[model samples]
Target chain A: MSVQERKQRERAERERLIVATARELAEQQGWDAVTTRRLAERIEYSQPVLYSHFRGKREIIGAVALQGATELAGALRAATVTADGPRARVAALARAYLDFAARNPAVYDAIFQLDGGLAYAQEDTPEPLKGAFAALQESLGEVAGNGVHAGLFTETFWAALHGLATLTRARRLPPEYIEQRVELLVDRLALV
Target chain B: MSVQERKQRERAERERLIVATARELAEQQGWDAVTTRRLAERIEYSQPVLYSHFRGKREIIGAVALQGATELAGALRAATVTADGPRARVAALARAYLDFAARNPAVYDAIFQLDGGLAYAQEDTPEPLKGAFAALQESLGEVAGNGVHAGLFTETFWAALHGLATLTRARRLPPEYIEQRVELLVDRLALV
Candidate 1:
């Protein structure tokens, strides 16, 4: 490969490294603790180098959100694919979603809560966000009738899942009954 | 009233004025703009006076959250009281919730997203928070079976509603379909 191509690849790798480091810092000590200077210190890079990769903390959050969206899509697809029936698939999907939120609270907050400056539900929305929505639409299509818009159903189902995940994380709900709640949601949405 | 008692009451009234001013500023310009100094300037009071009312911005947030919680409980009760059937009541409650979030984004954020140092789920939780939960549980009790725990069902249903509100505010879902989505959730959850 040419020298220029190799240098470009290296730059991309460094960008990914910065994002990974920021995500880890956020996960370890909530997003409030992840400062640019601390991120630079942890990655053993100058603050300027970090800024070269990201405009600011908000951009870094957007990068982490994109990474999270990709992971969430993969988990949703896996949950739906391995399940046996329509109701089972929906149940598994709900469980997988809640598990993801619990395991990655910071990343979830980045995507949903923080003002990451990422455009959502617009023409300029990122590919990862679209891909995540597609994954949900595909999974819900299994149970959604042909005349119904799968995208719409997916959005509604996703709203329910988000509610469960956020409320549970906030400790507004008892954690022990989460499984039963997911079961009820799946049975209710899928059976009818 | 005696002069000393009147003076004490005036001081308490000033504190309420400060909190109310801060809340209005947050609602108009978003939470990022509601700084202590700005609040002092808006209320025409000294910074020290503002500090006396609230230790800092966090305490102001707590006050706002409490107010929002009270408003939320009232809205839920109003919706619950007007509806006839379990399904209709649930749907109305969901609509009221989403509308409240949409109308009061900053207050909603203070109650749900920000770390305002308010206790949740414990017996020591603030009265407004507990009262809000009680209102939801009371409405949910109509649909939950006789043997089932109303609190658990309320939590699950609340989770779904919270998800819808947060996602809709974040633009993760289309605004036009919010009513249909709430209907779907109510129907699914209310069905025996």
Candidate 2:
């Protein structure tokens, strides 16, 4: 590779390493524990080096959220594609969405809960965030019912799933009935 | 009144003052701005006095959450009571719940978002929290459809509202369509 191209490749690799390390630290502890100093120490880089890539912790969170959004979109698409029909696809999507939230809570929080400094549902919204929403729309649009807006229906259904995921994680809702709750939500909300 | 009775009454009044001041500070600035020192200064009390009323910030949050729960339950009850039918009552309940969340974002965070050191959905759950759920149940139970456990149905419906409230507050969803979102949620999820 040319010298300038090699430098750009190295820069890209370092950025990925930084995001991965931050996400790992957040998952291990909590978001509060993912500090720049600790992240620098963990990545064996100087504070200045970390600062070069991210302005501060907020930008790091934004990076993590974007990465998370892409992964979430993929997970939902994968889950739905294997299902048999519209109802099945919707159910799979709900389960996949909830499972993603449950399994990678810190990443989920970065995308939805934390101040990741990401714009959403706007003209300037980032592609990964929009992709995640579109992933939901893909399955949900078919079930929006006549005379109802598909985007609005998806938003409502997604909100219900968000509620279940966060409440269950926070222990505000009983964990034992999550399966039944998922079934109830799908059966009632999805037109298919 | 006896001297001892007067002392007890004064203590109770002081406790109320502390909770009120903390809540006011949180509402005006956000939870992070609510420090014990700031709270003591706001309440015209020493740090020791504030600490005596609340073990720390967490206890203060718990107090705020309990208070919010009681107020929310009242708001839901009042909104649903005036509605003409089951469908109307459910719609009223949804609107009231979202309105309460929007108007009292800080207090809502205390009850749902922050770590208030509170137990939920348990035998030992506080009465105000239980009362809030009961308020939702009063209108929702009737429209839960056949065979579904009323409590589970209520939980599912409440999660949807919680999702909408948190997402709208976080600016993750379009604000203009909140009315239609509520109507869609009610029409789809509520059997009545």
Candidate 3:
């Protein structure tokens, strides 16, 4: 490999390291504790090096959110692939989405709650975000009834799943009723 | 009026004033700007007086959340009451819910996002919260279909509405599609 190519690869590797370290810190200690200075210390890099890759904590959070979106997209796609029918796939998708949020609370917050310096629902939205929506759309669109737009249906269904995930995490909903709620959502909403 | 009775009445009024001031301050400047010092100063009460009404910020937030719940219940009830049928009532309820969240962003945050020292979906849950669900169930129960628990169905529907509200607020979903999303949620989820 040429020297220039190697330098570019090293830069990409450092950026990945910074994002991974930030996500770890956020998951362990909450976002409030994930300051740039502390991230620098934990990553064993100078603050300047961290700043070189990310403008600040917000950009780092955006990176984590993007990585999280990519993961969520992959998980949703994998869960739906093995399901037998539209109804089963939708149910599996719901479970996978909720599980992702429950398992990765910090990353979920970065994508949904915190200011991650990411452009969402805009013309220039990032690829990973679009990918996450596409993941949901792939299954949900199949179940969206005639005369309904798939993208709109996906957004609505996605929002509902988001609500279930967040409210359950906040302890606003009974944990024991989670499966019942999911079943009800699928039975009631899925056209299949 | 008797002296003791008068004092009790006066104290209750003072508590209301404190809660209202804190809520207003929160709405205007945000929850971060809602320090006890600012609340006390705005209400023209000493810090001890503020403490007397509530222990600290968390309790103040709890008060706001309870108040917000009561208001939400009222809003939902008022909106659904005059609607022609189950479907129209559900649609009205959706509109009222999203409208409330948008109009009262800080209070909505208190009820959902922030830790407000409130019990939820439990035996010890607050009255206004119960009232809020009762309002939703009043309409949703009618359309819950056979053999399904209205409360569980209501919870699922509520989560969907919540997801729309929060995601829309966070800009995760396009604003222009808000009405379509609401319509889709009602059409898909509401049995009516």
Q: How would the candidate models be sorted by DockQ, starting from the highest?
A: 2, 3, 1
Ranking by lDDT: 2, 3, 1
Off by over 4 Å in 2: A1-5, B1-5
Per-prediction CA RMSD (Å): 2.0, 1.6, 2.6
**Candidate 3 regions off by >4 Å?**
A1-14, A45-52, B1-14, B44-49
Question: Candidate 2 - CAPRI tier?
Answer: high
Tens digit of lDDT per residue, candidate 1, span B6-46? 99999999888887887899889988999888988887887
Candidate 1 collision pairs: A163-B159, A163-B163
TM-score for all models, in order of appearance: 0.94, 0.96, 0.91
When sorted by TM-score, best at the front, the candidate numbers are 2, 1, 3
Candidate 1 lDDT by residue in tens digits, A132-179: 888877768777655556777788788888888887787666578888
lDDT by residue (tens digit), candidate 3, A1-192: 699999999899888888998899989988998988898888788889987887888899998999999999999999999999999999999999999999999999998888989999887999999999999999999989888888888898999999999999899888888889999888877898
CA lDDT for candidate 1? 0.84
Worst 10 residues of 3 chain B by lDDT: B183-192
DockQ of each: 0.73, 0.88, 0.81
What DockQ would candidate 2 receive versus the native complex?
0.88
**Number of the top-ranking candidate, with TM-score as the measure:** 2
Interface root mean square deviation for model 2, in Å?
0.6
